[model samples]
Target chain A: MHCLWCDADMIPELSWKTIFWLSRPTYLCPPCAEQLTILKGKRCGKCSRESDEEVCPDCRWWAADAAWDDPLVRNYAVFSYNDAMKEMIAKWKYRGDYCLGKVFEGAYQTAFKQAFSFLSREAVAVPIPLSDERMHERGFNQAKMLADFLPLKTWDILTRNHSEKQSKKTRRQRVTAANPFQLTRTVKHPVILADDIYTTGSTLRHAAFVLKEHGCPAVYALTLIRG
Target chain B: MDDYELSRRYAGKLLLRHEILIDEPRFEHLLNAHYFTSETAIQTKWSHHECRRCGNQKPSLFGQIPCHHCGETHVYCRKCIEMGRVMACSLLYEWTSPDQPWPSHPNACTWEGELTTAQQKASDLIVRKIQGREKEILTWAVCGAGKTEILYPGISEALKLGMRVCIATPRADVVRELLPRLREAFSGVYIQGLYGGSLEKDGTAQLMIATTHQLLRFKQAFDVMIIDEVDAFPYTHDTSLPFAAARAKKETSTTIYLTATPRQEQQMRMARKKLPHVFIPRRFHGHPMPVPVFHMCYSLKKDLQKSQPPKAFFKWFHHRKTPGRQLLIFVPTINLAGNLTQKLAAILSNSTTMAVHASDHDREEKVQQFREKRFQILVTTTILERGVTFPSVDVAILDAGHTVFDEAALVQIAGRAGRSPSDPTGEVVFFHDGKTEAMREAVRSITRMNKRGGFH
Candidate 1:
């Protein structure tokens, strides 16, 4: 495998981690990852994990040097969620079918290829993991299934650590949790995070922070849609 | 073709809603199977076959034929003519002359896209039917196949032939689409898009595009009648329109039927006689038909009753809506639509949303808003199910188990999505508290239609 950070080839080493029935190569060798610099999104640098060129409100109020969380950027979506999308959503949501998800895979892959082709080779995708409680209720995180098609090492990186639905919590509560992403298992660095949807960037941004804190390289997020 | 002349020949054929009938006609399986108002004063063809040469031989097809000896045309047998029964002798000729720079210019037809093969074929058929002087034609094409374009060729043909043509539908959208096309195609020709508000009593116009209900006012103003959305809501259900179409058509003119699904009589006739019909089963963009999937929800209902949302259902729903998949939601009633709208709003708080129903007096505004995507989820009844096409919107019926959710409604609701060339296949989800036989039928029907890749 080619080392993602150093751009050098590494001797093949086997691992027990198989993301799916399609047993595929999983990671970058240690040397390349060690040399990597993790992403520290320029967030408000304090509370909100999403950031821009400026130090956002919360960080400014706290008088903190808001440079730590400064890598995240606003996401660009491929299509508007039109009436057509609403219909598809209603059908799948009401009837409880998963095969309909396949239609978006090709489109999402196409968008990803066109928009982020430069990173395709080194990008290891990690689907935003569902908490154990939600997992038991919904049986799956749709993003995980879609991520399977891409050449990425998958992981249940975020263990919910706390069981509250991330949706219910205000942006602040999610990040302050004792352990947002447990890293129960680790993966190849320079990963691309995957999820079905992105809103407020609270979940992905927090996960990105945890991964960077754990010595992972720059985290890039890819989602079907962003809001 | 004057109004009086058309009426003389077709007087006893069918009764319009206002046709001086004291009592509504009950359909009977007589020699000629058709509905007849008790008020109908039928003049049986058996009464007279007035042929100048062959007096009283057995009456041939449809009560009108040529004389055996003189080879001259004969409308009645020798008995009626001799007895002064005076059966009307009529010569039928479909005058089809393409109006070069048709008196009606192509102003209304600003579709802004290339015509599909179905539209072309329908137009050609319209021309041929006019030329052949045929009484009826069935244009069995699907909803988005663009029925308006099919009528374009017929518009000018009817005009140059000096025929007054009326294009009728059970719904307004059909008229709305056709009005512009007809306006464009027959530019110089005086045309009227008639519905309830716009009525041309002077009969000054050569063409009329109107709802079937509007046909009641005309005694026989049209020589060629094209009915759009033949199997749609009111046509088959309302006793008046079909009868009016039959009554309004001039003896020398033609009537063409355009529909994706024809009524029972049309189907039975086609099947029994194996009558050939022009079929355009796909939308103009040439995409495969949508495949409908059925999800059994009875087990999920029990789970919901246990005070838990159906995990499997949510899993499936979340996966499909995983962005970029358009959707349509159909509910049994306006109230249900409202309730579901609230639930969906709560569930998908991040997504834009809107709900629409028949009860909404501001329906036109809501529909226009939905088209613009001012609101993503347009909560609707069957009103917007079939005719309104929004690109890429997949469809689902919330309570698939309801008895009101019949085969017709299901097919219409399922047709709401994947209209754009960019995204061609629709996602159909039938969500039921308890799975019903109709749900299975709906799924199977859609699958079969799509298995042929929409060639049907």
Candidate 2:
């Protein structure tokens, strides 16, 4: 097989140790896979950033607000938003290389099972949806692709109103902008919101706000990367 | 917007429709006034699978994306997606206006250096062709024949006639090397150097030097387009670059193709009298091309695999350790280059040798250090085959029979030797387990050029 990014020939190596750990061979070469900065070590409870503080400054700001009855519970991200991650996301999302969604499939599956083990089997995985125009252009919603790899029952419970892409907005604008997500169906079970990347935590928070405004009792989030 | 501002900004420029929308505040009035015309970037009908722009019918290069604006599925060409997405939904805007009078200086040629007699003759022919209405001309010169100097007179003629000119090459490194020389030669003319990360994309210039990929951003922009290294990689193999080159020039503009080793197709065309070409077989210093000597070494890769340099290669290296001569060894791949450099450094002990390839981030610095004589030998891949000249350098090709080394590449590699006038003779050795047709063709081409002799 050839690497998707560099087109280098990748001969699969047979080793009992690797097979035992990884279950299956990796599609990416060693060097190309090394470029990804996998998130590890002590992380913030709210945003899953590499942090020593129990509650990071951004999470403290979100918690200090009394506007909402229940604050954001927790979030988990699998990778750090390094330059390589940024480029990979751009190629996969903006360039419409849908095949690249599989690069994160194995990692996302492993991370998802580990992050949300406390939730029951009936807890639904609702992917953050794209507007109809974005869905038409991109053909497939990237967040839905990530959620498809989760071990939970996935559902399309939320819909997005047409607005400027969150990627094109500044942090202050993103945090202060009006919520663009609306609940399309009533849900009583616990929920896990899935997105490709968590930037500033405003997008997931907005989705969580809409879900909480409805009848959902609890909400959690999982993302591919934390920017 | 003022008519002058609109014309100055958008005239002779090819822009994507999305670019226009992003800059809508500036182009809104002009677009609405019908001053700008739009053409499909990659023309295609729903029934046809072939792309009109690049003529690619391969399914892998074609993709379908739902168009948000038109509410239809649009098939786009993905082969030239690096330039931009060219789809049925996309439009390329060209400003339709009267040609603005270009500024020309009285004395555009400021170079004091003299050209050889053969170069002067070729320069005259090129100048005459450019001044006349010839559509295409080929300048086929031997390696180290001072091909860049021969174009000076022709370019100066175009500049004096108030015509916009462009000197485009396939590689960005070539563009970087040619820019300063062209700037020094034509000091009076405004020259803009363009590449991937270039910042000088705004201004209008009399002479524009750019890579072939940058030509995609231009539309009928040049009156004369001179493509250097016409047979180089990516340009020769990829069809989109040649298409971009053709699209960058005006309908009536002249094109000059400059290359050291013309491909077989070009040679056949010239032989049939279908293409006009000029040939220069000798270097400016009156030296014939260096013929490479092939040495048989049994399984060099196997020997290197055991951490042993082949006996023949080591013997040659030990014998050719002269005082001032630097050695350049070309390997097939980057991994082999690194291993060979390590083994050679251990064997030589007294001399400093380094390996450089495309992925080496410090490649420019390493090359600059080699030029400064800090390294005695440099092991590299084809990344250094052309656009680099080191005086008093002996070249050796390991595994010359490797599939990566084509006839054109081998010729360019051998041409690296004997470049300096002070030391007109340098050794070129090809150590291979078996000789391939490419090696034989390289030797034969050099012998043929040598027989033609220099124009005195």
Candidate 3:
């Protein structure tokens, strides 16, 4: 009945391919998809980020804390990509087993509660967006499942565009998908982007760029664990 | 053109394409039905037709067929023809078959051994310490101390309590080695082996043996975790993964680290504060620790520049790397390994020399060749230096002055010698043009291990 990510105007479309493959009828308007796909500013490897044109040639890579080109506010992870996480993701992403998402229903809530508890109490949890093609192949997006499981009043704010897989590309080729996201909606609170894992910080940075562009005060990320 | 030639050309050069356009009302009807059928419903009379003779198509349901040049039935349902079934459509349903699924757990150990006297003693101490103290525990003993066997009772206890146990290694080959051992140890227990390139299976195992990277897949599924190579590659340099391991385990779950060479931080933690740790000084071989030496190669460049083998280093290598002894030569780069391999192959006799690296296209074959003793001399990069050992083998670090020769790398490289009992005596040489800080650090670590393991 409702779109999971940037809760834009919801419309249900039924196709055998969509139902059997995706099992969900939600769709992302072009604008909502853009929010989850841009690169924003300079970022610290451990946390904060800033805008840069390239892997800052002079970036001091730190074992504990280094700077990345784009900065996302905070990373909020629903679960660590472990047995539990794998069990849940397999169900949601491939096996069409919706019950796995139920196990970690409270995880995202706990993260949201902690992330938004003191500062920017109005901070909202935004599930990392999946590309439409991926959502189709996977049958369901686990992030969306977590959002729905919590009924966390989430907004489908970011959209990953149709692009080559980051794995399929070299790091530089992967960077080409950087910061292309554009946002069209208005935000009422700070956004804390939620995902499964945090690796290079590229995904969160891109999503934060879009959120910041939409007048959101700040974007923070929290993952179950930082990969 | 001949028909056969034309067909061959099409098959080789062209991709087949198919396109279909469904009537709007019938498409919606099928969508509403939510199942595939031989024929979708239509709101009006059938008016569309296709000419097989001329490849002509029409959108209207009712039309005169052009290719047939006849007033015949023009509209036919493509779904119906494809299905060849009456009044039935294709239906989609989910299936839970492993095409294949990632295995939920690692195969348990088959190295069946009831706790030996020492194992039982270690087990008792470990259990008491685990329950009593939250500080570090180091099980320092000889090679046959049965470090893995000691963990068994504890692991079985955890499994009975419905807690998760995971073991991670730095190498996949090690996982392969341990899989059978684990299978026998945890008989009837559903254990998962998690590693990269592992075939997919459901994650329902109580015990999981995984590579360190696969730990990335977990989110607090384990009550406890045992890191087999705690001081091994990807673990020492990878700070994020230790945190990842912590996240994968339950908050109250204890983290047990196993290694022959615990890094300085681990030692500091054991001495300065309480941290959970364990060690096996000697291997299964009941022998003294292998002595490590540093032989500086003064004329290494002169030999290479002259397209020659470093003569002094070669002489030292030749004496040890006889027919009976095995040798592991670690070079700084693949290109260097190649150069030395060619030279060694030409000069060496009564011994075989083979080279391997991460990029070696025939890595598996080379590893097999080494195991089968097809090659007595194995020139490799740092990749194989850890997690693999050849008994009675001498270790030579050429270009040991390079920065890639880190303290950990050198120590690990030196560790490969004298691992098995049959050939407990091995040699380690560092043929460096100049000594770097890492070279000294590595030598210090080895001597420290030797002294701490005095007369083991």
Candidate 4:
């Protein structure tokens, strides 16, 4: 086997204790794995951003704003948006290396379990949808692939209108921009949004607000990176 | 688009359908006029599998997915995904238009530097091979023998004949270095340099300097193909690159390989007299290549674990010949390079010492800074083993017996020393815990080259 990111040959280390627990195999080598700064230490309760307080200031603003209707939205990210993660995401998302999605499968599974551990009822993974024009260009929906890694049922019931990418907009612009997501069907169960990244917590908030308006009980987000 | 511009840009090039879709009306007109050819980008019919773009046929490297365009399960090639995603539904574009004659330059070479006697002989042999339309010829020249200068005469000859020429290497750094030099040498000709992120894609230039990976976009494009550093990485390992190189040349094109350390198959072919060959063992400065002195550092690993070099390394550093020259340390892994860089920086109390590897984002800038003497000591991996030159730097290998330091790599790493004409003699040391066959073969090879260069 070879590393999905760097293409270096990965020699599977065999030990006599291999019969123990059946954990998912990692797709990264030691050095590449070390580059991933997983969300650890003190973090915001609402968002996974590293913070000393219970909630980050940005999440606090979203809670105080009347326009948001004080929606219940919490985001859990797997890794920090460091330089290494940024490059890896660029290669996977923009450069269209589809196999790189497999590199994060193990980590995504772990994060999915941790993020949904507090759920009292069953939740469906809802991938954030791309606009029609962008979908044709990008070929595969990254959020869909990420949602596939979760053991829970995935419901892609959200449709997005053609809007500028959140990455291209400023934080202020992203927060103030109208919601691009709309519920394609009435939601019966709690929703967990699956996305590749969480930047400024606006995209998740917009989706969560829409789901809350549609009578979905609770809304949470599971993202790969906390930018 | 103008007829002349279309003919010049796409006459002998391969482009993706999306690349040519910018002007749909003109493309449709050209298609109706029989001036364009289209084919499926990925071939997955029956048991046959191939990627028309990068020529990848590995079944394992292909992925099947629900394609948006085709609205079905489509196979896409993952081998050359960095360039672009080539799926089964995608189309590749090629111009079937009549070939336009390239402009001729009677006196193309503008380099004023003189080649040495051995270099002049090799240059003449290259010119003869190209003029005779030979299949291929190997130029086995020692390091610092002015391999690039030898190609000037041959390229000038080809340009005088109104033939397109290209110099492809495996390393992008070489393309960057060769672009300026080739432009300066052939000032009258239009030159294009292609790499991973290069913006210029006109492909209409008469002279091209590109990395081998960039050649996948070309089809029978050049009349003369000069592959530099033929034994370097990716070229030696990637099977698709050699296929790309062959497909990028004309039917009767001449390929001239330039390498300092030829691989085993090449050596065997040369021995069997089945391949035309030329050898230049002398450097441009007429100095013997630096021979490496093997020093045993038994406790090297223990010392490095504690973030320090062995005492013998310090002893050699304190009593050095030409201590003012820059130092280059080659380690087997990136971990060692980073650890040693920090330890050396602290011990020497100099902030200029740094480490670089293949994945370093600031690698190009660091190398440029090192060229300008901004860094006194640079630690690196095998990424700098070939296709780069530093004027006056002493070279050392920390783990010379490591499996990564093969014979060819050791020779190339040793060649980093004694490159400039002014600083002809540079020190080289191999600090190994134990000697390996690769180290012995490297020493023997350097000694044999020195003997051929008339050094005692």
lDDT winner: 4
> Which numbered prediction scores highest in TM-score against the true structure?
4
lDDT by residue (B345-417, candidate 1, tens digit) is 7877877656787546577787777777767676677778666768767676666777778765676677666
Better candidate by DockQ, 2 or 3: 2
Give the proportion of true interface contacts each model preserves, from 0 to 1: 0.00, 0.03, 0.00, 0.60
Native contacts recovered by model 1: 0.00
Candidate 4 ranges beyond 4 A from true positions: A8-25, A120-122, B45-48, B305-307
Better of 1 and 3 by DockQ: 3
Candidates' chain B TM-scores in the order shown: 0.69, 0.92, 0.69, 0.96
Candidate 4 Cα lDDT to native: 0.87
* Number of the candidate with higher DockQ, 1 or 2: 2
Candidate 1 residues lying further than 4 Å off, grouped into runs, are A1-227, B1-114, B197-204, B274-276, B299-314, B434-437, B451-456
What docking tier does model 1 reach?
incorrect
lDDT of 2 at B10: 68
Residue B247, candidate 2: alpha-carbon lDDT: 81
Each model's lDDT comes to 0.57, 0.82, 0.57, 0.87
Global CA lDDT of candidate 3, please? 0.57
For model 2, what is the C-alpha lDDT against the true structure? 0.82
Model 3 chain A: lowest-lDDT 10 consecutive positions: A55-64
lDDT of 3 by residue, B1-456 (tens): 333332222211101011112355754554466422222221223444432211123232112111122323223322112111111121211111111112233323344557655457666766655454243366654433346778876676555555567887767777766766777787778667766566743334667788765654344456667777677766776554565566566556666676666678777878875665444544444455555676766888776665466767767865665437777888877677888888888888667788888756688688877877777889888888666645457778877887777777777777777777577767778887888888787777666656655553
* Cα lDDT tens digits for candidate 2, B1-456: 566666666677787765554366656766777888777766555666665445566555566655656778778765555555667767778888776778776679999899998899889999999989589999988889899999999998988888889988888778778889999999887788988767886636769888887777777888899999888877887776788789889999999999888999999999999889998888888888778999999868798676466899888887874646998999888878888888889988999999999777788899889888898999999988887878779999888999889999999899888887987778999989988999999999888888886322
